[model samples]
Target: MTIPYGYAKGTVISAPSLKPTRRDHETQYHLHFSVQVADEVWDVAVNVGTNDSDDLLKYKLVFDYRHPLIQTLQASPAGKNDLTDVNALPALDFVRSDLLGTTGRWRDSAVMDGSDTPEPVASLTRLIEKALSEKFDVYVFGRFYSEGNGIHDAHMNQGSKGRYIHRPNSDQNDHNAVWQDGAVLIDCRQPEWAAYFAAFEQQYLPTDDLGNPTPSSSPIS
Candidate 1:
């Protein structure tokens, strides 16, 4: 609940591409891309899986996301946005904001693979490509790097426990916050919005006001 760094907002200038990072002899999982905010191009990393494990239950993604929040995000300013209160703006809160909707719209990466449906990476890439071709306004949300022009954590930011909170060396609990969730939104500006959402199997819904898990919370099935 103590996210020291503020939220991330960017304007897509290039199509998203895959570029994996290596860490400690293991491949860090993510989809890399570039976004333009003003005159600078910032890197964007969206997690595709947990570590190197390709387990389908470990992740969830929604390709054609629809919500009332899309209208607000479509008109938001681009770039790294530092704000005093996220709840007052177009910020996201997966549980609180009902971004996932109630029709079980969230798709599991593994389930998609098993059912011959496009997986998270493929689905996201298709959206970005379409966004670029259609000249749609794209917005990416996450946390910006302190010394670099990039953003990561384009996924759910609450309901983590044990080692799933984050890296081992960091204060795991500090990364969770309400109304500051990470997401990627594509604004067609024609009353159509495509959104990409992700979450680990370990994350649960119904987070508290501080983004902590509640007693009645449950994982997305």
Candidate 2:
């Protein structure tokens, strides 16, 4: 998604190889890489800072998935952007194809849920790790949304915000003992396709036949 501010655009080029990790008795894809945007390579300096490596990788992957070029590359015959001009459902299919490749056919797939499902997570993680290792750079822009938002929200809701109890530098605590640090929240409650939403709000959503903003209970989500 484009941010409110203008940011440099970059390409997310992948390496020719993949890396695998064993977790929960399954193997997955991890891609290793840097990010290139506006002639600058982000998060590539050795020992840059805490969370820098992770942040760079995540940013690259997310933008890569959202890139229009990549979307065009993956568009299917029934799901191309042109089809959207005549059919809204076809447009939705195009969006789905953009996010999930041709191979991702199952509706409500485990990977889409952002859960610890073996196949999806493993596949993604391995792709990411491998990309990182191969040093393929993806062009990315904008700062990643901070982790504090979820934590603050959880605290406000009076939910148990969980503890960071794993002792650092202790042999008793393996890497798995540490808490996973990031959360991916997909906020599609409103029309998140900014351009499309703007057009719909101005023209179609408000009218019966002629142009008007009439009150209706129709859900945009």
Candidate 3:
């Protein structure tokens, strides 16, 4: 996979569109933004933010981005730019990538419910939905596709299977670690941010349109 990692901020290019909750097809809420860094308009998508439809994510709107580690990442040589740099800040090493680890951060700070979200989900959804057209800076990691672009793996880079070039594009390997990964951080001028941390699911997930689980030569995990 040719992944790009970088930081960008700009105006919302359009109202975020949602993909309606579903048991399949990976529900999402996506929008386009004019990023200042690349001088390009990019689509940013956030997943349902739950292990499943029945789960409620822990969503928090942080008003600051002064975490020492985050600052360190921004200060790294590869932090600001470099689209395809595997070592860029697009992927992080600190997040837990399990599907449902209680300590996992993926399920945090996002609205997962629909027009009837409840409690924290309700409130969180309102916050995100209302942030449209607002300017915000995001640590982004994504791949290029012919269709609409997405904000995939906007968090820690390790533990998730992805592309690996062992010898300059020769073979395929399970590169589920930091080296071939990308990480990001989202800080809003609200000084508040809707951090888009991510994690990969169980190996049995539907990862391909050809009806094949990724890296699976066995019986689909």
| Best candidate, lDDT | 1
Predicted candidate 2 versus true structure: per-residue lDDT over 2-81, tens digit per residue: 11111122322333232344434333232233444345433311100111211111111122223243333223221101
Model 3 lDDT, full chain set: 0.39
lDDT of 1 by residue, 83-128 (tens): 4245744666777655666435556653332121336767777777
The C-alpha RMSD in Å for every predicted model, in order, reads 4.5, 17.8, 7.9
Candidate 2 residue 200 C-alpha distance from true site, Å:
21
Per-candidate TM-scores read 0.76, 0.25, 0.50
Q: Score each candidate by Cα lDDT.
A: 0.63, 0.23, 0.39
Residue-pair clashes per candidate, as listed? 1, 25, 9
Off by over 4 Å in 2: 1-104, 107-117, 139-221
Residue 221 displacement in candidate 3 (angstroms): 19
Model 1: runs farther than 4 Å from truth? 4-10, 21-28, 51-65, 111-118, 163-174, 215-217
